[model samples]
Target: MNKLRLRVQILFTILTNGYVYGFLKGKIYQGPLKYTCVPGLNCYSCPGAAFSCPIGALQALLNREGFHVPFAVLGFFFLFGSLLGRFVCGWLCPFGLVQDLLHKIPLFRKLKRLPLHHILKFGKYAVLFFLVFIGSVFLFGGFAKIPAFCKYLCPSGTLFGALPLLTANPLLRSQTGGLFGWKLGILVLILFLSIIVYRPFCQYLCPLGAIYGLFNRFSLLQIHWDEDLCTSCAACENACPLSLTVQEISRSPECIRCGKCVKACPVSCLHFTAKSNGYSTKHQTCVPPGTNTV
Candidate 1:
C-alpha cells in the first residue's frame, strides 16, 4: 500500500506540476486551470504548477477588497479535511514526497526522532492560526502587499518557485532583494532539516497540514485498531515514520494516515474504517495517548 500510494503521489506531483517546458522557457502557466485550488502546497507561482495553492488563494482573497469570504476554497478545505484529513499529506503533497525521499538517503547520522517531537507537532497549528489566518486577515488585509507566510516562511515556494525562476530567468535577477535572501536561507534550513527529520516542514510548519490535522479525530476515514488481536510488540510504532507510539495508532493528530502502522501490524489488527462504524474494541484500550494506557 505504501509503495502504491507513493507512486500515486509522485504521479500526482508530476501531473500537477508538469509544465517542464514552462520551467525551461522561464514562463509561469497563466491558464484557466490556475483558478482551481490544489489541496496541497504546490506554489501557484511555480512555473510548472497547473493550479493555485489553496493557502495562496486564501491569502489573496483575504488581502482583497470588500472583506468577502472564499466559499469555494473554504468548502474545499472542509470537504477534504472531513473526508481524508492528512491523508492528502501522506499521499498527495509534493513537498511531503520530497521530504520522504530525502530522509531515505542512507546516513549513519539518522535523526529518527527529534527533541520535543510531541510538542513541535503543535507548531503547525500556531503557524496556521497566527501566520496564515491572522496575518492574512490583518497584516495583508491592511498594510502588506505580499502574504506573510508565503513571502517569508514557505520553503516550498522558495524551492519550487523562486529558485527555479531565478535560475531560469536572468532578467529577473535584478529584482532579487533582502527578502529573497531570507527565503533562500529558510529553504536551505528546511532542506537540511528534512534530510535528518521525517517531514520537518510538515510536522512543524505546514499550515495546510495543521488545518487537516484538526479533522483527524473525526474524519470519515480513520485507522481502527482491534486490541483483542494485539500483542504489544510495538512493531507499528517502529514502522511509523512519525513520532507515534503503538497506543496512538488509532487517532493521533500527528498521524498522516500513511498506513505504515497498518502495514507493520503482525496480526492484521489495524485497518481503515469509516468513523460512523463503531468497533467492538474495549474502551480502555482505544483511548488516545496520555488519557488511559501508555
Candidate 2:
C-alpha cells in the first residue's frame, strides 16, 4: 500500500508541478491552469506548480473586500472530501510525501510518539480557524489577501515556493531580511523534526488537513473493521500511521486511510469499503484506545 501511495504521490507531484524544466530557466508557470486548485497543499508560487492551493485560494477569497462564497474552492473540497477524505493527505499531498520520506530515514532514536500528542493534534483545528480563516480575513482590510499560514508557518511553501524562487532569482536573495530568516529557521526545524516524527505539520498545523479530516466521518471511501477478526491484539492500532484504533477506524477524523492498519491486521479482517458496508458482529469487538465503546 505504501508503495502504491508513493507512486500516487509521485504522479500527483509531477502532475501538479509538471513545469519542472521551466524552473531551471528561472520562470514560474503562469498558465491558465494556475486558476484551478489542487486538493493538496502545493504552493501557487512554486515555479513548477500547475495548480493553485485550495487552502490558499479559499483564504484569498475570504479576504476580499466584498463578501462572496468561493464555490469552486468549496465545491472542490466537498467533492474530494466526501469521496476520499484525508486519503488525499495520504496519497496526494507533496508535502506529506516529503514528510513520509524524511520519516523513512533510519534513526536509532526515533520520535515515534510524543507527550501530549493527542492534545497537540487539536492544534490543526486552531490553525484552520485562527490562522487561515481569521488572520486572512482580519489582518488585511486594505491589501488583496494575506495567507497567514502560508506566509508564516507552511514549511511546504518555504521549501517549494520561497527557497526555489529565491535560489533561482538572485535579486530576491539580496532582498532577504528578518522574516526570511525566521521562515528559513522554521523550515529547517520542520525538516529536522520530520526525520523523527511521522507528520508533525499535518498532525499539528495544516488547516487543509483539518478541513478534510472533518469529512472522514462520512466519506464514501472508508476503512472497514470486521468485528469477526477474532483476537483483539491491538496490532492495527500499532500499525496505524495516524494512530487510529480499530473501533475508531470506521469514522476517525485523524485517519489518513493509508491502509497500513488493514495491511497489519493478523486475521485479514480489515479492508477498504467502497461504500458503507455492515461488518460481522460475532467474531470480535474492540474498543478504541483511551475511550469506552459502551
Candidate 3:
C-alpha cells in the first residue's frame, strides 16, 4: 500500500504540475483548466501548476469586495471532503509528498511527540479560521483581493510559486523585499523541521488540512476498524504516523488514512472501506492500552 500510494502521489503531482512550458518560462498557467480546483493544497501560482488550489480558490472567493456566499468554492470543499476527506493530504498533496520524502531521510531522529503536541495540533484550525477564512474576507489592501494565507504563510506558495517565479522572471526578482525574506525563512524552517517531524505543516499549520480533516469521520472513504478481530493490542496506534489510536478513533479527524497502522497491525483488522462504521457496537470507545477487552 505504501509503494502504491507513493506511485499515486508521484503520478498525481506530475499530472497537476504538468505544464513544463510554464515552469521553464516562469508563467502561471492561464489555460481554461486552471479554473478547476484540485483537492490538494497545491499552489496555482506555481508556474507548472495545471490546476488551481482549493484553498487559493476559496480565499479568492472570500477575498472579493462583497460578502456574498462563496457557494462554488464551498461546494468544492464539501464534494471532496465528503468523498475523500484528508486522504488527499496523505496521497495527493505535492507538499505532502515533499514532507513524506523528507521524513524518510535518515539524517535526524524523527520525533512524533512534542511537549505540546495536543495543543499544537489545533494550530491548523486556527490558521483556517483566522488567516484563510477571516483574514481573506476582511484584511484587503485596497481593491485587490488578498489571499492572506497564501500571500503570508503558505510554504507551498513560497516553494513552488514565488521561488520559481522569481528565479525565471527578473522583474519579480528585482521587486523582492522583506516579505519575501520572511516567507523564505518560513519555508526553510519547515523544510528543516520536516527532516525530523513527519508532516509538520499538515499536522499543525495547513488550513486545507484543517478543512479536510473535519470530514474524516463523515467521508465515504475511511479506515474501518474490525471489532471482531479479537485482541486490542494498540499496535496500530504505535504505527500511526500521527500517533492517533487508529482502532479507537473511528476515523479520527487527524487521520490522513495513510494505512501505516493497517500495515503494522498484528491482527489484520484495520483496512480501508467505504462502509460506514461497521463495528458491531454503535458507540466507538477507546479500549485501554495493553488490554484485550475490545
Each model's lDDT comes to: 0.83, 0.82, 0.85
Score residue 217 of candidate 3 by CA lDDT. Answer: 79
Return model 2's CA RMSD, one decimal. 5.6
Which order, best to worst by lDDT? 3, 1, 2
Which of 1 and 3 is the better model by TM-score?
3
For model 1, the stretches where C-alpha displacement exceeds 4 angstroms are 140-142, 279-294
lDDT of 2 by residue, 53-124 (tens): 898898788877866787888999999999989989988999999999999999746775557997988999
Q: Model 1, 1-294: lDDT tens per residue?
A: 789888989999999999888799878998899888888889988889989898898888876665778787898799989988888898889999998888888764767557897788788988887787777767654665447789779999998899888889999877999989999998888888888888899988999998888888878888888777889888888898885886776467778888988898998778877666455243434677587343
**Higher-ranked by lDDT: 2 or 3:** 3
Candidate with top TM-score is 3
Best-to-worst order by TM-score is: 3, 2, 1
Q: Cα lDDT for residue 125, model 1?
A: 89
**After best superposition, candidate 1 residue 258: deviation in angstroms?**
1.3
lDDT of 3 by residue, 55-87 (tens): 899888887778878898889889999999999
Badly placed stretches (over 4 Å) of model 3 are: 140-145, 248-250, 276-294
Lowest summed lDDT window (length 10), candidate 3: 278-287
TM-score of each: 0.89, 0.89, 0.91
Model 2, runs deviating above 4 Å: 140-145, 276-294
